[model samples]
Target: MATVRTLRISLVCLFCLMFIAGFAYRSLRMTLHSASSGFYLLHSAPHNNSSPASMELELQDLMKVIEWPEPPGPIDYNFSTSPFKTEFHMPFPRATYYVGEYVEFLITARDHHGRLKTYGGDYFQAKLHSPKLKAGVTGSVTDHRNGTYTASFLLLWPGQVEISIRLVHSSEAIAILKDKRETRPDKVYFYGFFDGTNETMECNVELAGPDICKYLDAQTGESWFCKKPKQIPCNAYKGHSAGQSQDILTQKEASFLNKSVKEKLISSKVGTFMVSPKNNTNDRGICSSGLPNPNPSGFYYQDFWQSRVCRNRAFPTPSNVTKCLSGKIIYMFGDSTTYQWWNFLLDLIPSLQRQELHMKYPAPQLAIDPENEFAVQWQAHQRPLTMKYSDKEELHYIANELDRIGGAKEGLVIVINCMAHFISLPIRFYIKRLRSIRESVLRLIKRSPLAKVSIKSGNTGYLYIHGSDWLSLQLDTVMRAMFSGLPVTILDAWQMTSCHYEPHHLHPGPVIVKNEIDLMLSFICPK
Candidate 1:
């Protein structure tokens, strides 16, 4: 009897030990998997490490996963003689789609003689608008090259969503599609100090002397210029112009927008308004509750996601703004368009105190609001940038800058956009830069799951010939796809800047900039 009792006790103890061991093993495994998910998603299954050169070769091979839209090749027909006439056909005409369903359409181009142009090199801005909802979403444009193109969209809400289409790129993209020239914009935006006062100027300054470039005369002074001294380079303070705005909508353009004349708007039914409080999954905030542009004027906030915080309010009050940005750290890297976003935030939220850093004028602007406990940093990418930056700013790269900050726990938000400068280079160069940042971002989120990432999509700026809006927008799509796998939220600035009554300006004016910042704020504080 004693021996039997002893065996029973031993068995019970062994069973309890095994159960605890299993639970602990499971717990550790879950933790590790969660930490490494982003890395594995970006990288591949674990295998034997390769040589450094081999590893780079592997990265190059794997990074080829993102399929970039091929720039249009030389077509058999001449665009000058046979300009394209736009037409969009929905995949399911007169159908109602539910939230999260993909909305796709086919766009075909007809030539001057009213014939289907059998070659594709056109770029169109595809958007969904719900005036009542104040929500908009930009669709993907795929050039089929056989004259027809595909515009794809994801239905983000349920309601009466309207489909508005605009031909952002005229037939010009076809000619410059291959041998893109280096035509820069003529409009000059620069900020400089003559003696005491510093201000933003639209400088088209004349050369007064070898050393003195005359900016604005005290009387005729609407703009400012660097007082030319041989030492002071007049062009040094000059900002890169993205070319002039498309002044008047062409007869074809007018036909495309006005239904009575040529174009017609379509209404789509998104079955219901069913946006969650916040979807941290893709970091797309409350998209369901968006209020589309009431006047439905100009390109407004329209993306896969809508702003949770700005549905009813243009911007948070000074007192509440700090609260919205509390405990956040923002990193902005790109050209002036991106810097405009950073500047907008700094100017709008007065409570968010900025600590002046003695860095170059525009490049390394750093500010921290102690009250809100949020920090913002802007770093310019390596040169080919239009604006003349300080020597200190030239050494910066997005990947290295991100490394310097290390990882953050729900505190870091990185915004990357360098498309304007990259227009002259081949798409492959842009792809390489994007892949490098992608790997770094993957490693970052792997170490810190709570960190947030954002990409500002490039738009159809008024770069007439040298830079093709169609090409730029296509590159933007590639960038979006590259970061699609990671936990990044795209701002979809392309549609925001395009589709507006306003000219396709590279540096969008105040109203557009305001909307851009509001959308970003919504992402940071999706209440």
Candidate 2:
């Protein structure tokens, strides 16, 4: 009995030692993981297929693992993807490619020293355009994770099509963009004016100081911080405006970001080719919600966007648009890019006239066609909207405005876009705002199942430290991921703008905007 008891005690001691060792190992591993992970809390949760809360927890866990491209070594200009050194050519090089066929090309990334890069994360925009025809289309780029990329463009028209590749950002520049974006929200600052006083303070999406005033939105849990003024109270904050942008890029970093290297065209020996005649046949069903987003979602042929996700229709005249939007209450909520849609519609339709709201610029604009029995309104989303001084009261949270609808009415059309103004901030901040909006969207859908809602993806623009295309791509990824599996339409303006022959603009030209509006209207009146 004595021997047995001694053996049992020894076994128990060994078990305890093993348990303690395992616990310590796990703790250390988690510490290292948290230190290296992206901007989100790390915690484990059980997967429960029955609950959305469980799904969201899982989604966040997935987001925690979504790593942006990082440089393998210290930032060096010699290691960055170089437009002058990188080369692209047709992998097959056929004599004549027919329309409706894919024109595939291979790109090999090289550094400034003309040395072959071993990894791939370079932002490249590939397009086949005919300047004479005013035709252009974005190519779908596939990275092989081994420094090689494939850009495939669908030949939509028969003509002399030239291939142009622009190195939008080097992998090193993207690393810099990721670092500055997650760490330095103050790069692009805002101005906060105190009421009845000549006092102003620098404001931002994230700031920390003993002299800072923090404003937290209870509904969305979104926080904004501003440097405290000398004499004015935090409550005295009245008007808001955009402030000067402080350069955060170092001289070494700026070398990779100069205009000469940034968005610069690479010289290619693969000259223009003639496309043979072929019918552009698409059997895509009528435009509706929940269409699968295809690669190279659509292309511009003769300056008009053709969506492959759905059979997009065109509202050619004022009567066509009026007929489609008749008996609808359309609410456009977003930054200036989305506002362009409202502006475009108002300009196109003579019956829709602007109402005298007597409000400030960038305020809630309403246009009504009483005879047509329809109304269109555009309101900018809440804070972080950087514009010339505007009234603080004018900015409203999109989720709040969405909730105020109290169950949408029939023929209700809602377009939501809040990504551009958010690129400067951390991805976590954007996620929080999206969660609030998602919840409101759920409730809105629950109340009115027939309500038409569409989310316009971010456009391609901004190539600096504060707002880089790479940074926007990160947020855009999160937005698409968060809103996935929901009943909403995504106007893929990202691909539209990226592949266009025209220059990249935050506010894309009329052709792109018209295409976006057409896609939205196609969903509204899918005949």
> What are the lDDT scores of the predictions, listed in order?
0.52, 0.77
Best by lDDT: 2
* TM-score per model over all chains: 0.57, 0.85
Taking the tens digit of each residue's C-alpha lDDT, what string does model 1 give over 1-527? 66754644453343334334533553353334332111111112322223557646744654464333343443333332122355677656543456656667777776556577655555566776566656666666788877677877666555566666666543433344333322322222233322222433332222133343442211111122333423333433423222222233344433332323221232223232333232334432252221232212223434223433234234546655566666666778887888887787788777555555444655466666655556676767743344653342132446544544555555567788878866655555566567556666666777777777777778667463245565575577677666654567677677677644455678887777777766666666666
What C-alpha lDDT does candidate 2 achieve relative to the native structure? 0.77
For model 2, which pairs clash? 138-499
lDDT of candidate 1? Answer: 0.52
Best by TM-score: 2
Q: How many steric clashes between backbone atoms does each model show? A: 20, 1
**Per-residue lDDT tens digits of candidate 2, residues 1-527?**
66754644453344334334533553453344332111111123311212658646855765775564556777578878889999998879887789878879999999989999998778888888888887888787788878889988888888898998888888888878777777887788899887667877888887776777776554555566778777666756665788878887879988887878888888779988899998666688988787778776887777778888888888778899888987677889999888888889899988888877677568778777765667787888988877778665566678866765646446778899988888887677788778778878777888888999999999998654466777787888888877877899988999888877667888888877888888899999999
